[model samples]
Structure formats: structure tokens, C-alpha cells
Target: MRTGFRSVTAVVPIALAALAYAIVVPVTPARATPLPSRSAPQQRHVREVGDTAITTMDGVYTLAQATRGGNVFAAYCKSCHTPTFHSGPPFRAKWYGRSLVDLFVYVRREMPKNAPGSMSDADYTLAIAYLLRINGMPTGAKPLAADTAELRRIRLDSVPAASSPEGPAR
Candidate 1:
């Protein structure tokens, strides 16, 4: 009887520990290899009047917009994230193949961690532009429009072949 009680006590803690780990660690599915080179013609998806496929490589945001986003990031996000955090594997794991609208909505809804939804919608969109620029997405003549439909139209299909380790190019 005592031996059975001891066994139960030991197993209870182990079971609880396993339950806690399962609850805490999120499981992500295996991802495909990262796509390369925004400048590749094969990689670019042209958005025509009736055509719907558009990608980040198609110049989704402007330099000025990214610059403004950098400022907003410095003010609110820099406390926790360095510019490089927005690029490379980490960014890809979270955002690759997703639409920019996902990013916009995420930041608008759950960012700043302490004060979620604190910034203007435009500001959130601009921060996403900064993230794209740092990831080596080319700047467009026009800024990223802060519209859900427009943002949803552009998907992040590929990262650039070369991203500056220091930050976005000045």
C-alpha cells in the first residue's frame, strides 16, 4: 500500500510537469525552405487590373514610409527589439507566406505588449513597412497604403538575397 502511494506521488509530479510543458510550448509545423532574391523575375508577382497575386517583392512600401516606421519603432518598439530582430529567420518563421495585413493586424491588436492597440493604424502600417525594408524588400514609388484590402493583397513570398546585418540601407 505504501509503495503504491509513493509511486502515485512521483507520477503525479511528472504528469503535472509534462502538462505544464505542453501548455507552455507552442507547436509549429515544419516550414518550407526560405525563398530567395526579390529581384528575380520569377519571384515577382505582377498585380494587373484583373490579376490578384502580388508579393512583397513587387515594391509594396516606400523608403519614406519605412523611414517614418523606423522612427515609430524607435519610440515604442526599440525598447525590446533591435532593428535586426525584424529580419532573418525569426521574422521569416513568424511572417513568411503571410499577408502584410496579418502583420498590421497583429501589431495593431497585440503589440507594445504593455499597451496593445496604442498606436494609430497608420503608424502600425508604417512599422510593417520598416520591417519589410529591413528584410530587404524594395521600396516602391508609392507608400504602403493603410488599407486592409490593399495590405491583404500583398503577401510576403520571398526575402531578399542580401540583407544588411547592421540595419536597413541608409
Candidate 2:
């Protein structure tokens, strides 16, 4: 059986239609909707501070970690941040939003101006703990964790920097 040019030309429109259909379908990711704020306090047991929430009221930040952290922080942080707050808030101000530890996790995952996740986990933890201490958070027996869970529980009054001109693991 020999197929002529006219027969092949007749099927071209059908193939073109199928290809067009495949290209036009729309696909998108599901996005979560923001909930409206409640007037009255619903959960009395939990401590809520605006956006930053804390379940662990365990007052456990160590001096050793803070000292080390101050070093890592000065080396990595300081340019966008200052040892004390300037424009909007002060370093000693009460924590209304995110914790110092939360900032540390964010910095560790993404920091050092150009580079992120460059600091050792222990150093990052220490840096945040140290900042917390400087912010008036009392030190405790246990050391701070490098994980987000612990970091989110504590808030920062202001960002910290290297104690002096020098930096890292001080």
C-alpha cells in the first residue's frame, strides 16, 4: 500500500492540535492562606510573642557558647547588623518578634554576606546563646542547640557583633 502526499498532509492538522493542547494546561503549587487574628487569647498555656512562639521555657544558655558565638558572629555578621541596634530598635530592647537563636539558625543556613552555612554548628549555637545573654537572657546549665527548634524559642533584642576588632571563637 502506497500513501500519497495528500494523505500525510491530512494528518498534520490533527498532530498539531494534540501538541497545542499539551502546551496550554496550567499547573501551580498550593499556597497556604493567612488566618485572621483572634481578639481574645485562645491558648493560655502557651507563650506567644507576636510571630515568634516558644514552647521550651528552659533557661539554658552557657557562657562558653556565648563567648565562642560572639567570635563567629563578629566574623560573619556585623555589617548588616551592629553590636547595638540603631535605626529602629536597640540591642537591649525586649524581644517582640524573632529570637537570637532563630537568627543564628538563619545565619548558619544563610550568612557571612557572600557565603552561608560556613560557620561550625557549635560556633553558631554559641554565637546565638551569647547574643541571648547580652540581651538579658540568663545563662543555664545546658548549651544551646544548632537546630532551628531551639533557636526559635529564644528572641534577639538586637544583633551582636565581634567584641572588638578581632573575630571567631573568642
Best by lDDT: 1
Off by over 4 Å in 2: 1-58, 86-95, 99-101, 152-170
| lDDT score of residue 38 within candidate 2 | 36
Residue pairs whose backbone atoms clash in candidate 1 = none
lDDT by residue (1-170, candidate 1, tens digit) is 99988866865654554356445533322222222334556444543322466778767777877887887787668888887677877787888888888888889898766466656666777788888878878786666777887777778865653653235433
* lDDT of model 2 at position 159: 26
Local accuracy by lDDT, each model: 0.69, 0.49
Provide the lDDT at 22 for model 2.
Answer: 32
lDDT of 2 by residue, 53-168 (tens): 43222344666666666665565566666755512234434343556555665657776444455445665566666656555454555666655654655544322334322232
Q: For model 2, where is the 10-residue window of minimal lDDT?
A: 25-34
